[model samples]
Target chain A: MLNFDSQGLMPAVIVDDETGTVLLVAFMNQEAYQLTRESGQTHFFSRSRNRIWHKGEQSGNVQDVRDMFVNCEENSLLIRVKQHGDAACHEGYQSCYYRRLLPDESYEIVAERIFDPEDVYGTE
Target chain B: MLNFDSQGLMPAVIVDDETGTVLLVAFMNQEAYQLTRESGQTHFFSRSRNRIWHKGEQSGNVQDVRDMFVNCEENSLLIRVKQHGDAACHEGYQSCYYRRLLPDESYEIVAERIFDPEDVYGTE
Candidate 1:
């Protein structure tokens, strides 16, 4: 049996197949996980929204599944995918990680925005 | 304002600083984040138990904070750390990622067990 957490959720790591940089993290339930494997697309179960949502449903930044990895306990998953848009982050960055925390205990912006959030999400 | 999800949690990605390999994924609350930064260690908020937990408290495989990264929207965090001990996975592996999914839909074990989980967690 696949080990789902007490919440019936398993965390998924979305990463760029070529670059190996993580795009973001999301959660999946059994249904979402099965659908993802069958459809070869990325899908997440929104605990807050109480629904399964496609990755590119809003921003057209879909992730085409390349491969998957699981932890030994089968409780966590790593998804390697071919990212389809100029950005994966809702904030218009290629990767969600755009800022780095410095050794001085401050933060630094490390990545450039690949797309304009206002243009994609349309002013919100 | 930091975007805590509707569930009042933010997802965190843990990565090995030297190797750049993602170790695992966890979640944090504002309090957990503050403690992590202040203590230079990894802390997580367990949604299931509704408690704050130190990563290495039990396994002694603690993560020493090296740096941190925040996504553009401040919704997600990437933790760079120096992992202590031989393994970070409760399954006695170096990382939580140990199995790779093949194109044929079968899973392959890609990582070796660095330590004996039976010796640590005790025979289940």
Candidate 2:
């Protein structure tokens, strides 16, 4: 049996299926695991935010859980999610990861910007 | 001036610019902030993993950081990113934000599976 630290929460990597895009990653506690298993929708326990969040709660862009795999160590989870909507990012972008490391070990922005944050979050 | 607790780290949401996909979310310290600012690429501090992780370091799928926004509270950071390569999720899917909530408040898998994890991670 897998001994999970529900309070501690486990690490999970969320990935995109199409266009090979990675959407977002977060932690999953026992409650989240049970919820995810029961619901099949992506559920995460926000550490810094300290809350249980379901992707696309605020926005219509929801993450649909497809399959799950537990690491051999049984400490981490790799979740495959199918994204819906225009932009999963609250900032109005297609992905949260929009940076790349160049050959010189430096990074550069390669992808195009999609959404305006002011419209999404109602910036001040 | 914003009094940031570099040690404590700050919350960051990573999102895709295309198809409105959310890739991954992680924390960033002062150093990481500077690095990302200088590089224009996404960098994060893995809390549970306890290490500095550059997205797409292992896999070819790299997150290209596009723009950044600081929350009104001046605590959290919302980052815009562009994704390259296929299936950011280790399980090989279009997005990590898969699954959908039905009208019955139940969740269901909506997207099709694209890749096999064994091919990507190399099964044990």
Candidate 3:
């Protein structure tokens, strides 16, 4: 079981510890945090839209929480989970942090893309 | 080109505007801010490890920044990018957020997993 502050909100990131893969980052409100605590699942609060949005609610790319850790400060947290989608990224890729930066101050795309957006989300 | 506040650090999230794909979330320092402004690339400051990390420096999954937006409060920012990997999430899935919460307060995995952890990062 994980302990959460009474503040009712914590910054969290889902990471693949073995490969150092960062799945996604979001905040958890009291309900979301408690929900995640009761169940080994990942939940997040959408700061942009200001709503309680569960990952893969519509896409079926759910995160099964395996473990969780709070930072030394306890202000933020990290969760390790099992992903159920070919691409956790909404854009049809595995990781959201796919792009790399160059020493020259530029950046480039490096990861293999999976799932055609047209097929997954349907064409506009 | 993007302008930076004197504070030298800005919160940012890269998203695919079309599909509502949240590519990644990270902060930007002044140097990283300038770098992204000069070049259409995504850069972030790692608050955890406390360092400057680009999206796909090692994995080659780079983010090509297409657009940038600031919140109404201007405290946080958003970047629209083209991800180059099968999964932008480090856990070998597309998104780091891959879980859904049920009405019963439990959660479940819903997405399709892409790469096998054993193959992607080797066994424990």
Candidate 4:
């Protein structure tokens, strides 16, 4: 029942299966979704790069698919996954959600970086 | 630093502030983002409706935003909110993600419906 928008993509929410933390939000095209369904791992469409990327393909911090859910309208997808390696974020944080916005319109760093992106991507 | 895509929108991940359960995924436009920041409540641009909506405005199941987070690329938003009523899904489930996908390629109902959608939307 899932439907893509005019851009041929839908939003996917990645959550930590054990901790319930929202790891990140990504997008998926039909191809990415099909591969993810078949492989039981996260795959995404990069909006900027205009290509499909297997999660952690370069950094090796993969997200192991645990379960998937779709909204009642089938407009969005939610996937609970076990994060492999130290982080799910390229910035080396366990989650892409590291900064918390305050009421004063400023931000506070709420999470610690688990790996250094420079260390992971530089050598790649 | 948030940037909308070519469609002038970005993905918003809605999560339970305390439980961290992903409740739903929505889209936000510039106007919606501004109103959300001003009101501390969830506002979304309905792509299908072609307008802005204050969540729970119709069903009385509002989402009181607790915090906001932006990704490293500032392309997506993570919103942690407290749901006011029993449901966030129009289907009357506490979470839009009530069905879990099994390896067999079938869906299993994993969460209980907290309210009846017909009741809430009726007599409106």
Candidate 5:
């Protein structure tokens, strides 16, 4: 069995299968892990929402799992997937990692927005 | 400022700069984050040890940071680095994620071992 932290969650790193681009990092509870394995789609445990998150449930940006790997410690997971939508980040970037940290500790926008968040999410 | 979790730690995904291979996923406390930023090397907070960890401190497998990116949520970080040694995993694989999950829920060794853990860690 895979190890879960004290919180019963394990961090999962999602990557683009072909491009090797890191898409998102999220946590997965046992239920989420089992669901992903059964459905071949990425599901995560949202820490804030305290529920199982079906990726793209809100944005239609679901990730189709291509492959999965478990770290040696069994405390984390690496998932390669085919991202269904142009954006994986809720902020509209292709990747969640869109801000490059500079030498001076400032951040620069390094990725172009693939979609307009306002158009998709309809303004919080 | 980057958002740390309630435990004052943030997850960081380390990647190979040239290959874009996901090398490791670790955590960083504020001190470890500052040390990594100052030294241009990967420093992590060892949850097991409850202290700041300098990657390669004992194994001599240091990762030289090439670039860093903060996720849109400002909670996680992606670090691209030049890996110094043949392996990043204590178990002697280039990556910690060396075991691929088979469809039947079994694991397969997908990556070749780069070193012997017993030789390096003196058989813990």
Candidate 6:
């Protein structure tokens, strides 16, 4: 059995199938996990919203699963996928990990923003 | 500032600097984070052990940080490192993610075990 923690969630690391670049890290509840398996799309438990989130439901940046793996402890997952859109991050970057952390404890943008967030999500 | 969860922990994804292969996912509290920065080695907060764990302290498989990244939301981190020794998993695999999940929901070993856990950790 997959080991969900006390909060009934396990971390899922999403990776780019072709590039092997990690796209995002999200959490999955059992329901979200089953949904992802059944649908072959990414699903995550939204901690802030307290609901199941179908990734790319709003942005059309769906991730098509190529493969999934569980860690030795079975407490975490790694999913390699074909990202369907120009970007994965809500901030319009190809991956959420766009900033590099420097030794000085500061960060610098290391990736080119792929799209305009204002055009995709629109201003609220 | 990096966002730690309600429990004061943030997930850190470790990646192979040379291959971009994801090695492991672990949790880091602020102290562990600072220690990692200072020492250039991975440190994690062990949930079960209730303390900071210096990765490879006992096994001698320490991961030396090459670079680090932060996600857009600042809730997670990615660390690229030069992994010392042959393996990263306590289970004796190059990566903890050695099992690929099949469509039938069963998993298969996708990686070679580089060492024997019994030899490293001993029967405890």
TM-score of chain A of each: 0.91, 0.80, 0.81, 0.95, 0.96, 0.97
lDDT of 1 at A30: 90
- RMSD (CA, Å), each prediction: 2.9, 9.0, 12.4, 1.7, 0.9, 0.8
Order of quality (TM-score)? 6, 5, 4, 1, 3, 2
Kindly provide the TM-score of model 6 when superposed on the true structure, using C-alpha atoms. Answer: 0.98
TM-score, structure 3 vs. true? 0.50
Model 6 CAPRI rating: high
List residue ranges in candidate 4 displaced over 4 A. Answer: none
Winning model by lDDT: 6
Report the poorest 10 consecutive residues by lDDT, candidate 6 chain A.
Answer: A80-89
- Candidate 4 on B21-76: residue-level lDDT in tens? 78888899999999999998999999889999999998889998888998877788
Question: Chain B alone, model 5: TM-score?
Answer: 0.97
Which regions in candidate 2 have their CA more than 4 angstroms from the true location?
A1-7, A101-107, B1-124
By TM-score, the better pick of 2 and 3 is 3
User: Looking at the true structure's interface, with contacts defined as alpha carbon pairs within 8 Å between chains A and B, what fraction does model 6 recover?
Assistant: 0.90
Q: Candidates' interface RMSDs, in order?
A: 1.7, 8.9, 10.6, 1.2, 0.6, 0.5
Interface RMSD of 6: 0.5
Per DockQ, the best of the predicted structures is 6
Q: What is the lDDT of candidate 2?
A: 0.62
lDDT of 4 by residue, A27-78 (tens): 9999999999888899999988999999999987788898889888776889
Tens digits of lDDT, candidate 3, A29-108 = 87888777776677787756777778878678888887664432345555767887756677676766555444453445
> Which prediction has more favorable TM-score, 1 or 6?
6
lDDT of 1 at A109: 80
Share of true Cα-Cα contacts across chains kept by each model: 0.85, 0.00, 0.00, 0.82, 0.87, 0.90
Report lDDT per candidate: 0.85, 0.62, 0.63, 0.87, 0.93, 0.94
Q: Per-residue alpha-carbon lDDT of model 2 for B38-59, expressed as tens digits?
A: 7777777765688877766776
Local accuracy of candidate 3 as per-residue lDDT tens digits, B48-109: 66787777675566778776544323445556777776566555655544454444534455
Q: Give one digit per residue, the lDDT tens place, for model 6 in B8-69.
A: 99999999898788999999999999999999999999998999999999999999999999
What's the TM-score of every candidate structure?
Answer: 0.84, 0.50, 0.50, 0.95, 0.98, 0.98
